[model samples]
Target: MTDATLAQLDALPTDELRDRAFALARQRRDIKFFWDLFTHVTHSDDNTQDGWIGSLDASIDDAVALWREVTGHHYGDAEPLVRAAFIDYIMQHGK
Candidate 1:
């Protein structure tokens, strides 16, 4: 990505940046983007639990919470890397 593009994306709020990338991914039906998103969210710090909740209902809630946490920019220290990846993806495919 060009410096100008990077600068422009960086200027956006994290939530906005993520939303744009996600919207583009959805529009293009980009499996790789979704896969990467799943990987990132699952590998995030809070998801290191060894045991499953066992209940499908709880699991669904947990999944929803995880998505909200990450997309809401509450990803803690990983926020910068996540934002950068979103920016890079947008630069690469947002034409």
Candidate 2:
């Protein structure tokens, strides 16, 4: 995702974010990578960092929502569990 796209996404409401993400996920090979990076699952490098954060820089609200779905826990509510899962995903994927 480009900073421009992230800015566009950040401007959307949570629901719209989810809908757009899912819809794009279906067609985008890198959507999951972006989602993981945004949610802090994987290490973000220059190739993925700037745009990974957001077009205009933004909050993790939408990322948190996606995290909940991916882990079945409230966003950042279970700190250790969330961190563990985030790290585990990255480790398994070798990203």
Candidate 3:
């Protein structure tokens, strides 16, 4: 997502965030499943996994920044599980 899009999403109400999260989660899950299947079929090594981690870390930074901007709360005290899940999704599926 673009920074503008992320900001728009962040500006949404809490209920909208929940709904958007659900939609994003479904997309993330589908992508992860397909990526896993492809990797299994190709018998790829896990050595390339760091790329995904790096992408996910970038995503986490964006998310944390958005959360802080919208909610006026430090990212450190934000919901850890949600942050972790987002990171996990990116790590598993990001290109």
Candidate 4:
């Protein structure tokens, strides 16, 4: 992802970040893509113990950006609003 995109996202507060992330997750198949990439990245980071929302803004940004780049071309038929709610669930309750 471009620095500008990251910068734009990073500029938001946590609540807004949550809102944006949930909105982005509303994109078709976004949750599948995010979790697919997240699972892979987490496995790759197995040497380290990481948790939700990441430890740093850059790290979280990088992960999201990378996931987008890697799997953005394919989105399942999931409805925008549904996955967005899922993202909100993850943001609110995921470990």
TM-score of every model versus the real structure:
0.66, 0.29, 0.27, 0.29
- Residues 28-61 of candidate 3 have per-residue lDDT tens digits of 5444432332233223436534344234334433
> Compared with the true structure, what per-residue lDDT tens digits does model 4 show for residues 1-33?
123343454445544544455445554335454
| C-alpha lDDT of all candidate models, in order | 0.66, 0.42, 0.40, 0.45
lDDT of 3: 0.40
Q: Which model scores highest in TM-score?
A: 1
List the lowest-lDDT window of 10 residues for candidate 4. Answer: 73-82
Q: Evaluate residue 42 in candidate 4 and report its C-alpha lDDT on the 0 to 100 scale.
A: 43
Worst 10 residues of 3 by lDDT: 33-42
Native-to-model Cα distance after best TM-score fit, residue 62 in candidate 4, in Å = 1.2
Say which candidate scores most in lDDT: 1
CA-only RMSD, every prediction: 5.7, 15.0, 14.2, 13.1
Which of candidates 2 and 4 reaches a greater lDDT?
Answer: 4
Candidate 2 C-alpha lDDT tens digits along 17-51: 44444444433443454455355532322453445
Candidate structures ordered by lDDT, highest first: 1, 4, 2, 3
The lowest-lDDT stretch of 10 consecutive residues in candidate 1 is 52-61
lDDT of 1 by residue, 2-74 (tens): 3447778899998888788877776776656655665665575565444432234443335445456645657
